[model samples]
Target: MPETYRVAIMGATGAVGTELLDLLAERNFPVEELVLLASPRSVGRELTFKGQSIKVQDINQIDFSDIDLVLASAGGSVSKEWAPKAAAAGAIVVDNSSAFRMDPTVPLIVPEVNPEAVLEHKGIIANPNCTTILMGVALWPLHQYQPIERVVVSTYQSASGAGARAMEEVKQQAQAILRDEKPVTEAFPYPLAFNLFPHNSPLDDRGYCQEEMKMVNETRKIFGVSDLRLSATCVRVPVLRAHSEAINIEFQQPLAVAKALELLHAAPGIKVVEDWDANYFPMPMEASGQDDVLVGRVRTDLSHKCGLELWLSGDQIRKGAALNAVQIAELLVKKQLLKSKTVA
Candidate 1:
């Protein structure tokens, strides 16, 4: 018989948190007990799971001692403070925040790219940034076919990346603009309804935003290539759900278009969606609510013989956050990697 474990979701009221709840039930995780936790303000809010209303609890009030697994997605600051506490209380935390991603003692993971890393965790495992997870799953297979030299990527991120509040704010902004009214700026500094901008994450002395650097650094970590030459330009688009990326990769050797498509199609967590005749390729609308990353537009970069260009779209809230976390939890249970200390 399979072991049914107690599970707790930190930040259960947020966008990704809610999605995590859905995926856990949909995938039929063997959850003997489930607890939904969030900030104090969110306490008492009821969330449904397997047709049962689970009331949200104060994150500060929970006793992690009874929980075997914790899926945390509150935010970096929240995770920085609470994750260690949860782990100290004997829960294995799979965190969906950037707080511990770069920590030498912590393992940053995308199950498709580095499932083994999950076994190295002391008590907490870090889920890579959403963009990193989406790209890593799509590119890792190709990188394995041949070593990659350099990667240049541009992202079209949607409102969902900012959470459900921002998603609603975009719709409100669009309606206000249609009524010839001033669009309010709350979730974002600029209007995202019909406009786009460079990623708004704080910039550093090098002029690169935090979001851009996450792609650059997290990719190298997960790929185990410390000096993997990579550059990213992240833009926030008006799309409501999924994220799209245009990637140009230079490999050690030129990979033929057919071969690259074949590799991507065969890769787990990927769906090849190309139609040259209609000029149709992976699109965000089609990728939303999906479990797989939709990839297409495979072609050779004419300028460099070793370069290949492709496009991809994935649900930011689903694969980027919820599904990936759930996958990690599943991997942990399957491999008996839960409770890293016990595994050690």
Candidate 2:
């Protein structure tokens, strides 16, 4: 048997952090010791792990010397501050924030498509944005058959991608609207209940939201195609869990819907749910709480040669953040990277 790992979960109280805790237990990740870390405000808080209650530790006070892996999901700033420190202390850090993804030195990873990149990491591995992760998962198989020339995507993301405060905003706004009261906005610039906002984050100079740019850049990095043409429009919807995207791709070689479906169905970590005759397709409600990226609504784009379109959906906090990080940690263990007590 492989050596058990000592794992630390930073941001133990947030939505994605909490989901990581559950995933660790569910996957039986060969964890010998689990350290839960959070900000000073969450110190002394109790969180249950493997039937035992564990107290959350303020990140500043924890010793990382013995930790085999650190899964961080606190936020970009927290990750930027602590990830390198933890790595310097000898733990492999799998980060769920956008802090290090574009750092060139840090490998932006999606295990199914780029597991080899994890080996080239300088101590930290960055998880791609939730939207980008699912998009790449659905496209990689096709890309392998025929290189994609260009990609156009529009995301219908969930409130959970913004964090717990945004989820509460959706719930509160929904209740107020039902009670004949005007809903107030706090987590979003506009009321999220019964509404759709075309913006997912602050817009960059190119007029694409930050979230959209993440999809553009991360996709190129994970695919190792720096010149890959990609454009995205990310939007926030009232959905509470899973995020969905409409994707159009132009490939170098022709790919039929049937062949694409076959490839997606055989791909690991993906589920093909295209059955239009049964009125079945990928939806946020069904994709919620599931680990697989659901793909459906496949059709040929009539506008261009070798063009195809599809819909992708998955739990933002799961495949998007916590679950993917945990899976990378698992890969580290399987490859014996986490077993060695070496830091680089």
Candidate 3:
């Protein structure tokens, strides 16, 4: 584009939205203007960006025509109504929502896994779900060496996946429980303080919840493997940030643990964080605030000769959502793929 692009962050007050602000400043994205869009309730509230106080604007009242890049972390319903409008108004939208992820027209992207997919975006680019992004970054390196035959994953997701309020709710719930008071439940159906549960998303006829199915479908799209066999079990844990996953991959041929660890160590957007002597691998606490997906526990699976097992922890809000979106924007900038005036 231009010397610098005018960018906007939709749902700018939410957890992911705020992270977007921080990442853009930290990464030094080519920003001429940074607009923050939120709900009417959050209007007039100010958020810091490069030490500048930018007021949150009502999404309904903002004009998108001159905005070149829109980083959308608003909920699905909000993005559903606004993202297209932003794209149609000539801004390329990187949407962090489930609304258009499975849409054949929209390319589901994880910059590390499918940076080429950024070029295929018609107008709006879909950011893969947090759990999907975490697993994809960790698995794609190995999959590149040999095509993965199947994938089995279970997620220990944190409250940050829900949003800012949900994260605070967990803290409040823990406090209320210490006082022997009933924890308030609003952000989630149950108190996520002292307990965990199967993902609260709606379940389908096959019994997989929405969060689980998202991993299954989005990973296939990102990997360009429509028939990729994958299964997921997502759980909400008491952790406030970062997400962890235990993944099992069946490859076409036997892959050694040393080879797997070597691949991960050299892979982009990933860090091999194994400390066997201390019995520590990637933990959510350590993964928090880090840009890289921390991966460790590489070993061969006993059930199958060609199977490999691994574990990963990543900042769900940073690398999982906002960072992935920011990387897509950077890819666009590098490839000269973004347009000043997107024609819908």
Each prediction's TM-score against the native? 0.98, 0.97, 0.97
Local distance difference test, each candidate: 0.92, 0.91, 0.93
Q: Model 1 over residues 149-175: C-alpha lDDT tens digits?
A: 999999999999999999999999999
Q: Which ten residues in a row have the lowest lDDT in candidate 3?
A: 335-344
Give the C-alpha miss distance for residue 181 in model 2, angstroms. Answer: 0.6
lDDT of 2 at 165: 82
Where does candidate 1 stray beyond 4 Å? 339-344
Worst ten-residue run, lDDT, model 2?
335-344
Candidate 2, residues 1-344, lDDT tens digits: the string is 55787899999999999999999999999888889998888899999988999999888778888788999999999999999999998889999999999999998999999999988888899989999999999999999988999999999999998898899989999999999999989889999899999864778787988888999999999999999999998899999999999999999988998898888889989999877889899999999999999999999999987999999899999998898999899888877778545332
Clashing pairs in 3: none
Query: Candidate 1: minimum summed lDDT over ten consecutive residues — where?
Result: 335-344
Q: By how many angstroms RMSD does model 2 differ from the true structure?
A: 1.7
Candidates 1 and 3 compared: the better one by TM-score is 1
lDDT tens per residue, model 3, 268-343? 9999999899999999999999999999999999999999999999999999999999999999888887655433
- Model 3, residue 14: distance off in Å is 0.5
